[model samples]
Target: MKYSPLLSELISALTCLPGVGNKSAQRMAFSLLERNRDGALKLSAVLHNAMEHIRHCERCRTFTEEPVCEICRHPQRNESGLLCIVESPQDVLAIEQTSSYQGMYFVLMGHLSPIDGVGPADIGLDELEARLKKEPVEEVILATNPTVEGEATAHYISQLCDSMNISATRIAHGVPVGGELEYIDGNTLTHAFSGRRKL
Candidate 1:
């Protein structure tokens, strides 16, 4: 059976979301039309408003409606003199959930992938360098993912920090708090051993 033109368009649009394929999108389109038209309208309105208003934070590159994100504007975070560099805005949200870190953040938006043509300049290293030179940041915590590209990005940022006479430290990559040693991968096991502290 052929879907109506508007129904087909709605299904296609829903498939653009991550993990939502054609089948899932079709199901969603059907469910919205048959069961929850009001909810769908609300979703459409919110999505349109967000698309129109949301933009990257000027300082951290995180999604926000304001010029700078709330974290960047917080005076106490600035006083901490710590800058945590992360790969994405989601990473910043994850770190904030812990409530353990009291510092500002810089979102890279992505890792360096030479094969993909990503470079230091592409990931906002120039802006970071300028911030380092002007701000009183005493330490930079590289909280990028543990992928190969993430490692390279962290190393590059470390060297940049060194050139500016600032300290840069990579977040430890190792086993989780409750993870069993037997289930851990070799690379993660190695990192856990290498990052071990005297306890």
Candidate 2:
């Protein structure tokens, strides 16, 4: 028997999530319908609420319910001579897991991609520069992913820092080539931070 239009649409919508194919979407839809109607409703409600309530923090660009995220609001986090640069909020979480970095962070929200027309402006580089000038950051760590694009983005930022006369560095070689910071273990991340070198 064919499923109703609404059910088919719901299953199709579920495929928007990464790695969820049609089969998995269908299974998820069936599971939600069969044994957990209330759970499914709660899921939908949470999704809607998060979409409406969560916004990028003005300082770090991490998603938060308030104007500034918890990290930016923290009193004890090292505000002076801070580190600044990241690809995403997940990267921030990964670094936080290590508990080794005490400096403030600035999320890029994206990397520089010339082909994709994603330039420095697209990722809030202007805001980053402004922050660097306004804040007392002695070092800026470029913690982008270990990919070609990530390297290019880091290089560009490093050059920008040279012009601004701010000390800049990149995370050390403990991070595997082509691996993302979010995927690396906390211990490795801690080592990388400790061994960071000048750009």
lDDT of each: 0.93, 0.88
What RMSD does each model have against the real structure? 1.1, 5.9
lDDT of 1 by residue, 94-157 (tens): 9999999999999999999999999889999999988998899999999999889999999999
Kindly list the per-residue Cα lDDT of model 2 for residues 1-199, writing each as its tens digit.
7789999899999999999999999999999999999999999999999999999999888889999888887776755577758999899989989888888888988899999999999999998888878877788899998788898999999998999898889876578779998999987898788877889
**Candidate 2: 10-residue stretch with minimal lDDT:** 75-84
TM-score of each: 0.96, 0.84
- The list of candidate 2 runs beyond 4 A from truth reads 174-199
Winning model by lDDT: 1
Count of clashing residue pairs in every prediction: 0, 1
Error of 2 at 78 (Å): 4.7
State in Å the error of residue 15, model 2. 1.7
lDDT, candidate 2, equals 0.88
